[model samples]
Target: MNKTTVPSAPYTRRPPSPPQLPYPIFLNQPRRAGSRAEFVLTPSYDNVDPGQLTAEDLAIITQNQPQLVAPNVSGDWRYEQRREAQRILEFLYIGPHAVIRDHDFLRREGITMIVVARDSRLANRSMASVDRAGGTLGVRCQYIDVEGPRDLIHGFPQTIRDINDHLLSVYRGQMQEMDKNDRLLRKSDPPVRGKVLVTCESGNELAPAIVAAYIMSVFGKDMQSALQFVGLQRFCACFDENTKRLLQSWQDILRARASVARARTPVPGRPVPEAKPKRRLDQLRDHNDDEMGLGECTMDRERFLGRDAFVPFVDITNDNAS
Candidate 1:
């Protein structure tokens, strides 16, 4: 027994294995209300290891969690290239960004006016760009600021009217200047004398509604037709159902106003009679004029020639007298 005890291993206990962690150690931890922490402890028994998740998988899982998502920024941040209308010449443009972002493109396209369909704050920013560009571009930039969607709907009729009036006034001023300078006018019917960019935060709903309303106002198209025409120009142009109804209501109002205007407007090619009672010719005549000279020449012929001077007369004996 003493011989066999030569190399008996010293009595030793194997080191204890690390304790296995619960599938997700934080599963039972309480989450704070409204916490924006990205990681959420979700328990699963499918034998999938948390360490096995790829970055993309983790990202997708995190994205699925509502608390960690970010809010959307305004549409102004999503700038895009200026798009011209297909039905109209570059007279009208639609865009998501401010005109200042595309100053060069505007200069190249001869955009003289910028109709910014945004709130005051956003419009002010765009207006600053317009002012900066105006100094170098040698052109005046006009801006139109429309209130947000609700206000726009409430004031749609007046808003569109005001915009049309501004456009007409600017275009007329340009035409007058051109005429004064003896410049050749652009030959397009519904002349593209003024280039206006109608824009909103995203150039999505409000801008399109305004543009469509403009089309309906200027081009005499129905709301549906106007929207379709705008859609043709910019495929993304659209309006919600409420906006469509507002537009339709506006169209009705416009039609009513137009009818009233036509009724009030005197017919062309015929002069309107004066509303005041007419005065007699004698009452209108100036009595002092008769004293000066009434239907008679006032020249003094006697002073030019003596009273005895005789005028030459044709005679039958002229042939013999010569």
Candidate 2:
């Protein structure tokens, strides 16, 4: 017989709780009457801070500003000529209705192609004017009509590409004609000697954007530089926010495409070997170095510098012997 008794659980004492703060805690106290009065009496520009202008105010200001008037170069047509590159025989002549109205000027300037960048209605009207002028001038008209400025902005990249392709074809045809005439092709000279006319409703915004796009695509200039170049040629070549954003978007697309193309192209050299996995510390150090992005040392002794690398030695032995 075993007398087994369960031992009673030992009593455990809990630690004492921290003291609580008084119930009513005031986060923000009222300002003094004097301070409040001073704030109320303070004078401000419409109670609006200098850096606190709303978007609506900016828009209103922009709207209220007087629109710049481009110089009337050719009647009501609003024309201006721009030459991008000096060596290139062709120049970009931009204007409004005056381009189609004046046939003699087109022929005299040797404008072989007329690009109409406007709505269908305006384009058709201009085309009709060109028709009335007659085909005797031998100036070919091309209509590239989008809905409005926004539509033109969105579709600008493709539109410029198409126009450039057409121009290239025209230049190629001229080269073939030159070849047929048994002319010696000079590498230094432009293949085509024809000029191009780019026009829209008004040669202010849309036309300049198109010309800037052309310069960006053909000459590999960035959007800002192209815009600046075009602006220099045309006084009224100002772009709105939407148009500028579209151009920037198009430029980014072009750069991405170029990078992809370059990546796809095979390099004419041995393939690089895959690097071995580095230690954790090495990887961390490498990552820090990459983040710093320091340029390569130009003063490296192994680097080639034709004359700078060559150290001149004086003939001291001959002088000592003498």
Candidate 3:
């Protein structure tokens, strides 16, 4: 759907501490690493018969996989219908830019971080107040200086990293605090809580793309799964053909990287010697033009000029030659 049809945060009182969400915040955090292909293999939702799943494999899958259905987040009858920040996962919310300054909403939801992705062309008002609002609310605000929705492809990798890194760091800090407190009080550790809001002017294009990218990378999901999950929570989010193609390329890049990891991961009994460390691919590298399947229009030269500017080549060898 085009923007012609659809319609479109900061400042808080209370403690700077983020509130704990209902679901486990560390679902995507792998407990172990190296040659754990079983943990990283993208699940196939296809109609195929796997022999069976082991107890350990099943445990890992169940823990990491989030329920993709819309959450029963509130008692409000119109919660899903209203224009609010969608809790896509236990820890991630995707919604409009208006929530940045929403003090009660932020503290109530336990949101600690706000990621702003906007385009100048689509900007109707200045976002200079974003930082001031976040500061007041005591929320961390990170900006993605993108041209617009279409330009968000360039920021996907970094945005995903920013979100993941922050969440992990928050979890580690909580763990350290828990360890220190437990030594004296002998109390159980509380849940590690950190939530990041990914939003743009309307939460339709740029924000959704970033959310989908995060879901894809952190959850090892393909394009379809990621978008569907986001759309279910926030129906208004839109991705045009060009944006979809860009994500398709991004998925391809991720799949390629996952394959390499699988190969390097050691088998149960065998240990692979560590190779020299290489530069990390923290950015989504551009794939070939044909990868996006744009070659189908190569022969339709007239379409490029204008559909009405249709021009047929003459049969020079025949009498009908021009």
Candidate 4:
């Protein structure tokens, strides 16, 4: 019931596209010589309950929040996970960039969401019911069940990276196929694009969300871009491994939904891999300060003396304390 407030610091805004630098940067470059592109990346794991988002948290999210839609609920805190899922759907539907909110309706447009439930039977049953209900009203909703090992829920980021990497590979192959055909795709292949949303029954695990966010940060530009990188990971009804396989079988359906309507060839040049960035901590020494006080440090290392020699961060509070 306790609420968490958004950090007081302002969110950083990013430029439209990856910045162009003097030198060419590789995909896995240690430090992207240039800026990254803006994209969403919000992947949560099984145990985290969405309904628990406090008012302060919501206030921070409202700045650029999208329309969310999920199942309606009463005061039952236990069902908050499902309720929050419904809220996200509502935001997605009414959100400015959203064209489709339902997972099944994604086929009409080039969009996709990969949702892995802990309980596949329940996931499928829920999805089927939604689809059937939508049909009665003339709204078509077709959803695919995503299956994966239960261990994947614990290894959320790695799993998400695997999926994203796989998606990228698939897109690359599709572009190559178009290139072979010498169609419009051969001339200009667009990047393979899609989104993922992984969930579980309890809404407790957050590993997947952390991993997804880290991946997006490595590739995406800003926080919203990271948010857009993925969707809410709902912890809903439980599921089993068998149900998981049934869900995985639907990858083709997701691929179909995400496929490009028109073929567009990618740039002729090959993309290079990025190098890993060196963490500042790696360069610091672990020796106690007292041991090195006598200036027995390495020649390459410089020593700091008075305030005149030490440059504090611009935001450091109480400058006189320095």
Best by TM-score: 3
Candidate order (lDDT): 3, 2, 1, 4
How far residue 190's Cα lies from its native spot in candidate 2, in Å, is 7.4
Alpha-carbon TM-score of each model against the true structure: 0.47, 0.51, 0.59, 0.27
Q: For residues 36-106, what per-residue lDDT tens digits would candidate 4 score against the true structure?
A: 32223233212222222333433332322443222222222354334233223211221111122343444
**Candidate 2 lDDT, 6-49, residue by residue in tens:** 22344345985444322221223354654321111111122122
Please give the distance, in angstroms, between residue 228's alpha carbon in candidate 4 and its true position after superposition. 12
**lDDT measured at residue 127 in model 1 versus the true structure, 0 to 100:** 56
Instruction: Give the whole-model CA lDDT for all candidates, comma-separated.
Output: 0.52, 0.53, 0.63, 0.34
Relative to the true structure, candidate 4 reaches a TM of 0.27
lDDT value for candidate 4?
A: 0.34
**Which segments of model 1 are wrong by more than 4 Å?**
1-90, 120-127, 138-147, 154-192, 266-322
Q: Return whichever of 2 and 3 wins on TM-score.
A: 3
Candidate 1 Cα RMSD (Å): 43.0
Task: State how far residue 93 of model 4 sits from its true place (Å).
Answer: 12
RMSD of each: 43.0, 29.1, 17.2, 19.6
Residue 217 of model 4: what lDDT?
Answer: 24
| Model 1 per-residue lDDT tens digits across residues 159-239 | 555554545554545343355568846445444454666666667777778777765554445666555555544555556
